[model samples]
Target chain A: MQVTRRQLLQAGLLATAGLVIPALGRTADNSKENLLLSSVTDKDDKNWWVLSDSQGNILAQHLLPGRGHGSARHPSGKSAVIVGRRPATFMSVVEVSPQGEYKFTDLTSATGRHFFGHAVYSVDGKFIYTTENDFDNGRGVIVVRDISNDYKVIAEWESGGIGPHELRMMPDGHTLVIANGGILTRPDQPREKLNLDTMKPNLAYLDTRTGEMLSKHELPDHQLSIRHIDVADTGRVWIGCQYEGMALDPMPLVYHHDLNQGGLQAAEASMDTWRALKHYTGSVVADNQQGIIGISSPRGDRVTFWDNQSGKHLQDIKLRDVCGLIPSPNGKQFVATTGKGDIAIIDAQTLAVTSESRTPELHWDNHLQVLA
Target chain B: MRNCLLILILLCSTFSHAAEREPEAYLKMLNQALKLIQPAHQLFADQAEELHNQIGQLCQSPSEDSLQTTRNQWRKTMESWMKVSVIQFGPLLENDSRLRIQAWPIRARLLTMGIKQLETAEAPPTLEQIAQGTVAVQGLPALEALLFRTDALSGLQQGQACAAAQTIAEHLIVLANTLNQRWQNEFGRDFADPVNTPGGFDTPQEAFDEYMNGLVTAVQQIKRRKLEDPLGLAGKPGKAGATESYLSENSRDNLHNNLTALILYLTGGEGYGVDDDLIAQDPDSIAVLVLDDRIKGITKYNKQLTMPLEALVKPATPEAEAQREVAESIFKELSLLNKAFENQIFEALGVTRDFNSEDGD
Candidate 1:
């Protein structure tokens, strides 16, 4: 493709300065005309906080645990799962009230000494699974517990990868998508060396019923580790990678899976395929309809747009280590939560941040979840 | 038409292909380095983990003797990793100009080394180890080639702390040289158009240069406006109420404007996004928007433009003789940033513990 002056200008700016400030005037056009995105702040909220559009005035919100990024809600929306990290990696199972208040009726996995609490509910909401790193041996495990009634320690599944970072419910009801990061680390220590030599990302589908490892796939050796996963509505998987290189280079990459093939396929087919595949990946998610996958790297400060079908690069936008990305309630917009803690909304079509909301408590705002 | 396009492409390609013989030597050297350094990075990481575990265990123990013993062991482990990482990765940048620019694995190794020391140190060491480690730790930053625009000095200090706690400012100047060389090399490849390069960049090179330049310039300004000089009102204006202070807020703001100009010029006037309107604001007026809570010196202010800042650090003791100490501290920080920046750039090119950036495709 012939390079346009605009493309050249943009590319030049991105390479030199490492930043892109969009036109600020776009924020005036309200995304949700009925519900003002302005009042979407979590005000001195104490016990329960949810992003709610309950009155149809805004999107959905819920009161999750104080450290919200570590938890995931079930696809069914019947129960909200929250992981608390202090004292230990603790999970609180709460019954969600219509008013967005969570009744704290249950807590699980509190006995462990150091729990780096990363948990997700099964598609059916019958089980709650989380990764717990044993501080003693530097080993990690995927604790599959029974939350059928409140929460209980049903079974524990060991993460095949050294540090299993996050999990998602694969479209096929039987499999749980797990990102087994190959970095061996103690709970207190930031991930030690990424086992680069024999490092293989354990992209596996564990049978939730038996807590047995069914199908597992690994990444190439040089890739430091795989940490995040987003399963599309169609059962395809988008995985985000981190800690591949230092801050200078691109933040590794975002990979997609052939729902049928069991391993990661090229996120985009053309253009130096392998080289592009290894950039540091971050949070990966499919939109509400699961048509497009959104991948952001705060380190790379860019979010790539991939065509869900052919896996072509439709476009990419310059943003920071966008640690967290979520589709708007309606899926017309993408809400990107940066590592610096600025929340921005990008139009699904234009792929531009239409609005931004910066909250005071934005330190390392890693993930964003829409409470039903 | 196809032949003509091909000829045009070939002619364009030749000028841009600076070191293009399949990148064989560079790739081979990188692969060899990865084979060696990947193990080293991992070993250091593993050792750091072990030390952290031991420290954790020691902290749990009620006995002071046990704690002291554990601290010693931890220090030993840290010293070992720091030495191996520097030795293994530092030489590559020193030896090869191309590697200096493209070798990310070496840089990744260095970052891991710094991270290993910082993370494993957990808390500041005992005064004795702190003293010893200061000498050892301070040198790591000087070895780093890539310097981050933000927190470069802090990163250097982090390296400095690991060295033995005693400041090593002189080594930092050397580090700055390495960083400048690496940046020039990488920037030349990543950004410069034929006209810009006096040599040309490949499509990928051109694209990457633009991308990095824009991204970096934006980040600098973002940090400047939001994190650094909010409005610039820092540093006393030079003169009395003659009219404007010697370093009037306007001048300080102007300094920020100048820093942006510097970044734009350095990056080929392509990457920066600060519009002309913002650039046009008086330097002193811009200087009035300074913020305190953020790190100082991250954005510079001067008579003309906001200078690109080094990492902001705690102000030193106030005394006339302290001038030497301040200069030493500045030198130390610059060295550390240079080393760290080089490491970051190397890693960005795809070189890491096990993977060389050049090996990707």
Candidate 2:
């Protein structure tokens, strides 16, 4: 086959990325036990919050009140909530009974505030903390909802930055770590980042009980918009960044921080690999089983895994329209979903794709929440 | 044509077997794209080359008859362009090539400045230089202005504007030839068998997605931009100037060519309609049949239209009402096609137009 100059250049870049990220070593976890949850866009332009087994079989699905984004589940695993995507004014809270019956409720955000498409239930399952855009103030805030009292907005707390996205409780169970994305945007423009030059993204730790600011760690580069995150049991916060800088300027995409150590460490991938990541990561999964951090880039159509200890790129899997990622219930595998409807589980250690399925006629959106 | 009738019968009878016939349907799509759609682009290049030659002939001897013949040639070339216009990816996507060929609405200020500069400059810009100039006087739209202007023949007789017209024509041929050559020899051939190449496009499914999406968006443009906007569905009446090709009064033909090319892609050109093959074994071939009728409806309306699209919105004549009816029908047909793809063809085939422009934040 003849190789044109453009083709050769592309091959060179991929080959360079391959040098640091190894071909996935094969290992299989025959587990189909974990239930995965996601917001899906179906063929008929309808949106649904969907739950499936690790094998991607639909277990339960419900029509969302509106278009949805990342979901939050109560620690008990019996209930979950789907937050409407940015600028959407609603949230759906759903509970699945042991008998498989479902109960649902709709909660509205306060005036001038909109859910930023992600919410996390308190570890005790009492309150759900959602990342929201305080559009009037152009700041990110965590809106606390009392699940016991009809999921009402009980309290609000500053996220310590402008655009707080995905947040998770610390391993200690008392502190919540937030990825305050630092970019400012309004509901009118929706996802447009109004402030970039002065944007200050940080990984912030807050006292869950008092809403007191604990510590905030910012990356060396201001242009890197720290957004999505997943927490390991060891308290290392793995972050995925969406760059708000120039498209041509290459920047680090994956990061991890030890709140104890007090600094953000960039997951070291080759420049070629980082470029292939397209300066965007839609989601991140931290596997406790093997300390693997999985980050998905939908634009690049790639899921890259890295070692948490060394911050080294372990392996990279090529997928078309890949975005969602989560560690399976067993933590031994990562269930990855794509906008093209692929649901594949990669073994955390070997990075081998153990099983795969395609949900015909469905487009899985940016985040997948798994109950291990 | 006989084969089409046979396929139509086959499609209607066993429509529920889409799952079983899905692979064959996709393969046929690949084959038809390579065979029928690829040639449409080559024909566009060939016609563009002819137009360049005709413009040169008109410049050599300015006459009313020759100018009229040249205008006819322009219409034919544009129709050819619309026929192959759905191939928006691969070779056609490079270097502002598509926009250079046809920038709509004509940026009046830049065009006036460009023409003024051309007239006043002692050394007029050459074909290559004009190719590098602004889009206003760069391609077909520029040629339209140069030819259709009321003062065209007078300016041609004075040996001014003729060189620029001929130069724009040659530049268009260059772009068209480049696109045609690249598609026919390299990109089109490689894209047909994407799995064979190791650099990217991980699966055969991705190649299918690319082809179908190209056609899908082309159809979308025809419905949303070409027809609705001019017909005052997108805008209020008397705003047909938002219509494409308005200067030459060919917006209806532009739309007709668009739908004609879209139908050509839909059916694979005298072959089984993609919906027919993909939905052949599915229960929803009923939607496909309606879609088929709607396409025929568009063709019928095009045949019956008595005036250009510009008149459809202005003065609100009875014929304008007729045009409005055709526009509404075309809109419904486009919706049916979209639904058929979403519910039956694309779903049964397990492909997703995931990166489609319609997705929200």
Candidate 3:
């Protein structure tokens, strides 16, 4: 008999409650037990925030009113929050109880603002910071929410640029690094970029405690929209950029900024390698343990790896529409998800696919998260 | 649940069949497309050279006959470009060839500023200078403003304006020849054997997907940029000024050529083409039927328009109103054509519609 998603989720809940249902055919691999979370559009055209084991088994899910983009897992591993895609008006928080039950709370965007599809939890998990577009004012803002007070908005700070995207906290736990994309857009126009010629993208380091801008770095070319980022434990930040200029213009799509170095430097790659990326980098992730950085270009249908220490190109693996990437729990491998419904684990040292599975029913979105 | 299982089984069968189809079939289609495309590029180059020569003649000795001949040659060159613009891959995508040949939705303000600078310059800009300038003033749209805009005839009769037009015409010849040479040489060979050649596709399916994507994007450009934006069918008041080829009054002809080129691409000029592949997958495929009917419907409505697109969009009289109606009908048919490709053709052919191209962060 075929198992339904509802039944599988129920089995997961029961297992979490210390009751095993052997008839449900749970795989016997407790060593690889972390749950991967992603926003997906299913075959039936429904949006969902899903949690699945490394083997691609759906464990829990919550239907979303709209498409979701990035997700953040709470430090305690008991909850995760998913933000709707850009020009977003809703965010969903899903909490899993020890009894295997799921509680979902939906939050609306603050007035005159829209979520930029990414958010981060504080090191203590007491607050959540989200990037938003203050459309009427033509500025990007960071909204701080008190996770303990029912996710209430407590403060807002300037993001120091126009179209700020992904943000991450530095290892110091007091600084927030933001990728200001620099393309001016309004809620009325939605995805239509209003400014490209005069846009100035920057990498900003902000003191989260006082809402002060610490330092900001900008690229010489104004059209490179720095969109996504990943920070290693050692405080090296990797950024992925999407170029808004002509397609024929050869521009590097990945860059790194070291807190100690104090400048934005392009990742060293041959011009041929840069051309193959099709001028778009959807996601950037780093494995500090192995000193490797991986940047994915869904437009180019490949994921390229680089030496984190030297910023030199290493190798690329071809995977159609592969975007979401994260370091595995052990930091010895990388877990990747694609829009084609593929989940793959690549050995960090050899860059070999250790395991892969395809669901065909779920089209994973841009970002992925792992529940600790 | 039972119905879902049945659907899954059917999809798996279709997918396996698509995978098992010989790569030779797709290669044959690619070769056939090249056959049509190579000569189209050659013709465009030939026409550009002729336009260049005619402009030089008119500039050397200004007259109504010479100017008219030069304008006529420009029209021929533009028509030739429309035929091959559907092939947006390979050499056309390399080195800014497409933009250098014909950058459209022309930045009118920038073009005017560039022209003014050219008019006051001490010497006429050379071909290299034109090539090095901004894309807005380097190609056919710029030439159109120089040769067809108000007072253009007087402007081009022995001054810096005529010299600027001449240099731009020369630049077009160089751009067109480079595109044709690259397409005929290495890129052509690599494209033919996509699975084996370096810098080529990884699979025959990928090559086929590229071809289909080119065709689909062309149709979408025609519908959205050519029609909807100018006609205000996309939820704003119609702007006659936004119509492409407004100065030349050739917008309707450009649309007609675009549709003709799309149909030719689908049929592969009477050879094995996408249409054949669709029928081979399933004889009663709805995608093929919709595609054929919509093309015919669009062609019929386009042919019924008695006025240019700019005038039809403004609709000043009863006759213009009828023409506007015909234009709207064409937009509807183009919409249906785009839908068929997006919904059915990609799935039936086992081609994955690119996610990032459609929606990306």
The candidate maximizing TM-score is 3
Q: Which candidate gets the maximum DockQ versus the true structure? A: 3
Candidate 1 lDDT, tens digit per residue, A203-281?
A: 8778777778777776664465777788887777877666454333223256777655756764654433223333555
Alpha-carbon TM-score of each model against the true structure: 0.47, 0.63, 0.78
Which prediction has more favorable lDDT, 1 or 3?
3
| Candidate 3 chain B: 10-residue stretch with minimal lDDT | B11-20
lDDT ranking of the models: 3, 2, 1
Candidates arranged by TM-score, highest first: 3, 2, 1
In lDDT terms, how accurate is model 1? 0.44
The clash count for each model shown is: 114, 8, 0
Q: What is the lDDT of residue B245 in candidate 2?
A: 74
The sequence of per-residue lDDT tens digits that candidate 3 reaches over residues A172-290 is 99899999999888878877887888899999999999999999999877888999998978788999999886434356888899985868999899866776787788878878889
TM-score for candidate 2: 0.63
lDDT of 3 by residue, B1-361 (tens): 8567645654544433123457877788888888888899899989999999999998888887887888898899999999988886667766667767877765567777778788778899988888877777788988888888777778886458988998999899999999888778777666777777776676666677677777777888899888998998967778787788888898988888888888888888788887787787676666566666786897688678668889976789999888888999989998988876755666666665555545788
| lDDT to native, each model | 0.44, 0.73, 0.80
Model 3 misplaced stretches (Cα beyond 4 Å): A1-37, A48-63, A73-80, A89-114, A132-141, A145-164, A179-206, A211-226, A229-281, A284-363, A369-372, B1-28, B116-129, B151-167, B196-199
Model 3: fnat (fraction of native contacts): 0.24
